[model samples]
Target chain A: MDVLTTPLTAFSQYFSKSDYVLALPMILLTVFALGILMIDLMLPEEWKRLNALTALIGLGFSAAAVFRIHSLLGPEVSCIPGFFGTVVMDRFAVYFFYLFLVGAAVAVLMSVKYLEIERENHGEYYALILFSVIGMMAMACGYDIIMLFIGLELMALSTYVLVGFLRRDQRSNEAALKYLILGAFSSGIFAYGLSLFYGLTGSTNLGTIAQGLEKRISANPNDPVVIFALLAVSTGLLFKIAAVPFHQWAPDAYEGAPTAITGFMSVAVKSAAWALLLRMFLFGFYPLRALYVPMLIFVALATLTGGNLAAITQTNTKRLLAYSSIAHVGYMLLGLIASDGTSNTTGIKGIMFYLLVYTFMNLGAFAVIASLRRREIIGDDLDDLAGLYKKAPVEAVLMLIFLLSLAGIPPLAGFYGKYFIFLSLVETGHFALAGIAVLYAVVGLYYYLKMANAMFMREETTAEPVKSSPSMSLALAICAIGTIGIGLFPNVFIELVNWSMSGANAATIAQLMH
Target chain B: MMPVATTFFFYFLSIIAVVSAIVVITRKSPVHSALALITTLLSLAGLYLMLYAPFVAAVQIVLYAGGIMVLFLFVIMLVNLEKAQLEERFNKQWQVALIAVLTLGALLIFIFEKGRSVFPQTVTNFPENTNTQVIGLLLYRDYLMPFELASLLLLVAIVGAVVMAKKRV
Candidate 1:
């Protein structure tokens, strides 16, 4: 009891000392989300497009706020306090806030045309996406487990609806039903785990939990209940990350959802999940490393095998990308497995850098997919993309960059992302896992190139030309610039990732050594 | 003392929960399924009461059994159920049943084998009264934010369901 009250009092004192400049991005996003919801309600049906525009304006302001906060805080500022220590304003969260805002902005841009064609364009659609983005931002900034769970559910519930946005489609309906049942089940399990953890630790704050775990482990290391609680928590996070055995819904959901929304899911949700995963594993469960490392390695292996092998046989473009995202998750887990005391910093930095690069390439690839629509046919199949270069040179070229980047070809953003992740693996002396990762990367590259070849090398089968909208073009351009820019000048992002990891490492070490 | 009666109550509620859950899955009529679910919900509430969470028990009965189940029944009736195609509502997998049985059997074995070691005997001394007031106090004082946010979530769900089910503007 004294423990909890002390933090509250100290937090209040901290808030009294601090200013609101650091919390500007979160404030902007919260107001923007509410504003968009209100505008959606107020506007007439004819002005529904205004909802999308509103989301864009809100996201623009959020991006500006992120930049402003980052500049003001520099690399060392720890923005804490506010909302009773629920939100942690720091470089790590600010980076993810920018990533999610940019990703949501691009998704909204792509949705404008796609929703029109599908006749599912409604204010609620844009409002839900914005709400989910807000949820992701909340999860990124959350400092407490209670806040984390709330943010997580906010994102999950909205996504369950978004996954089945096209109600007329039976596949979409089935996907939504499956997602809801499984997501709710996992959430229940997660909540149960959290309750147990809180009972044991006497607090739900991450920092406090870390301290408690360190103390408990040092006092008596073999408590079976602690092991069980850790397993349950890791299981819940694994479900969110779509790690093996829990990833049965991803392919179906991705294939069934709107393409642009799938892009948003692929990048934004994955990044947010990784952020929470990093915080939990690097803090709360660090003392139980012996238990988690093997479990993580096994999951990484299964995810890699499942994703890469399934992707090879996929005929649907969305499902292929779904599998590809799973494979990327496998690589991310490699970083986690390699995160021992010696190289924990590098592992986290690698994950951050990969997430940064992945946001651009994956979103850009889906943008091209969104652009591949005509009067009668939706471009969901690989054959639909046949001879895309002949139809739309710019879209095809953009897709080429995206595929190459995903394939980790040199001088592209994806290459650097892979390089950093693999470098971290090698540095941790996990040469065997690094080797397998490289081998799987080759397997992944084959399919990416197969798609690229189909686009560039094949002859035009259909006479109808592909059209690109201005919003989509702008999204693609931003993604393309980000991909190339990060590839050429990786230092700025590397520095930022290093700075974030340093804060996380210092906090982790402090708790552990105490 | 009514130790035997208490044991009987536990067995009776367990049977009720199991039977209703089965009915929920296997009943052909949607109305029957919904009613069965209400029964399951009620039995679960009773079990919660046995476990000394009288507040959750009441909320379970009122919120889930009364409100949500009624809403489910209403939706079932509101839709054109008579004209709707009545096909197999579940996956036709005979192997799945076998797998489920085997898995449950294995789980039972594992639990029986490890139960003594895994579950330490700890006596829970409850207060003389465990009711809605105590629960409400705890919720407001310790879990204030989550309780408030849960209401907000329910509000979102209400608005979302209305928007989703409504006809075009």
Candidate 2:
């Protein structure tokens, strides 16, 4: 038998040219992370800040590789499968890849000073973030459930250490343990779901699974195995995104983890999970939409209500933002519910646009918190933020802009993101759900403004002036511009998302035609 | 193929596994519990081999029984032994957890009933150790991406272990 005696086959059989070229980004990221680890050992303590630049350069190189792949694939939306079709360099992946890079860049910028403030400024921090971004890009590019699982584990494992990276703090240790326990449980459940899907379809490839499920569902509409798979898979991902019922770990984790890692979890992790969810629904579970959609509807409603109501009771600013993040997941799920996975631009584009908008808004908010979080003072309390206007005028104003945008004010990026989702929902005739989403958004605004009101309206609590480094300010500036720019000129970003997803929409249309 | 000896061995393994699992929970000393856990794991591996999955059985014995259980014992010993013994046996919410578990078990039975059409009772015969070759080829070929990505996860775990246990950042 060839298996017993033959030498390995040539690489050409399993890998296309794109596998090597498109893979350059992840390869370089890994090299950079390892290089930083080695370099950190040799560098004198005084020169440790150089790791940030090294990380930025690595990110820049990988982003440029993404662009090169984009040009190679051309403007026509196409899925250029590689790594034996387990991964694809498609416009959908490219979109998320770019967003992840942008989020990583901003997070690194925010961390530069904050790490020094907390006295945990190690090169491994930057290396870990880069590694986490690689996992996210893998999830975005994954066309196989196994690929997605590995990607999720890579991201989740890196983040667990990153959360507890503040080893000296007991709160950080507790948060890390809780997150690890809950996260591992969810991963187990997720794997169980994937196993069931594999058993039912006898395939792991998304395309093959889709084909198999469509035939099976046509014969038996209420397939218990498929419904259970949907429940298990969604539960696992919803935990990642910090949606309701599975969200117990989030508030404490967000409040305990170093501020920058919290922002990373809120943005990069959320986007990666959403990307996987979208892929699963659009591909493997397409025939069971009727089965899965009701589940999502119930989840979205509960998440919105629980997130806003619990947020209203939180005194810790970090905890409030945690709840707010949950509420945002609810809004994004609406877009998924509205889309039928055909050549529909509105729903997918809305989710993409909202994720991008959320990156700027959420990162900007955390940057303000980081600015105030110096050694000996963990200033993430609503009371501490009171009179923030007097302590740091620029931060206060930027926080106001960010919070208002998060609250979905007109002419801001968040409003457009929500509006697009609402538009899609109306088009899909989910008028009641659309109305509930809006009402919840209004309720969410109240809590968001409480932060703003405390900052601008309350008297000073301390005489301390919030000190922020140039790099942190630069991150804030980028976020502020994005929040305002996308808000003011919404069409540019919306059009870009539509163009990138054109390839995905085409793929979906072909699948529907089957 | 339907040997009485094999059937007798299967039931023996199942009974041992259930009894050891119960002992694992009931034991007062963590060391005793960990020992019981190893017995449970070894019996489960025997069950897997009897089900024609020799590779899985080997992995179960090697990873769970040998590697993980040792680690578990080490942790139980390393932690404050006196304080752990003094703490409550169960949490305040054990009753709620028990009720929830029972409900879940009932729901699973309902699901099994609903999907009974596909839950075939017969088991297929396979050539000895063929699953090893089949799984190896699958992992190395079509699932190569995830296979490699799994290595990345392990690397992350290693990094996490070092970062968490290290004295200084």
TM-score of each: 0.81, 0.85
lDDT of model 1 at position A269: 86
**Which candidate ranks first by DockQ, i.e. highest?**
2
Which candidate ranks first by TM-score, i.e. highest? 2
Worst lDDT run of 10 residues, candidate 2 chain A, spans: A1-10
DockQ of each: 0.15, 0.43
In candidate 2 the C-alpha lDDT for residue B21 amounts to 90
iRMS (Å) per candidate: 4.2, 2.5
Question: How well does candidate 1 match the true structure in TM-score terms?
Answer: 0.81
State the lDDT of candidate 1 residue by residue for A334-401, as single tens digits.
98888653345667677888998999999999988888865677787898889988888888888989
lDDT per residue, candidate 1, B36-145, as tens digits?
99889999998888877777888998899998887898899887766543757577796898799999999999978876564434555566274666666656644444
Model 2, stretches more than 4 Å misplaced? A1-12, A509-514, B1-116, B119-133
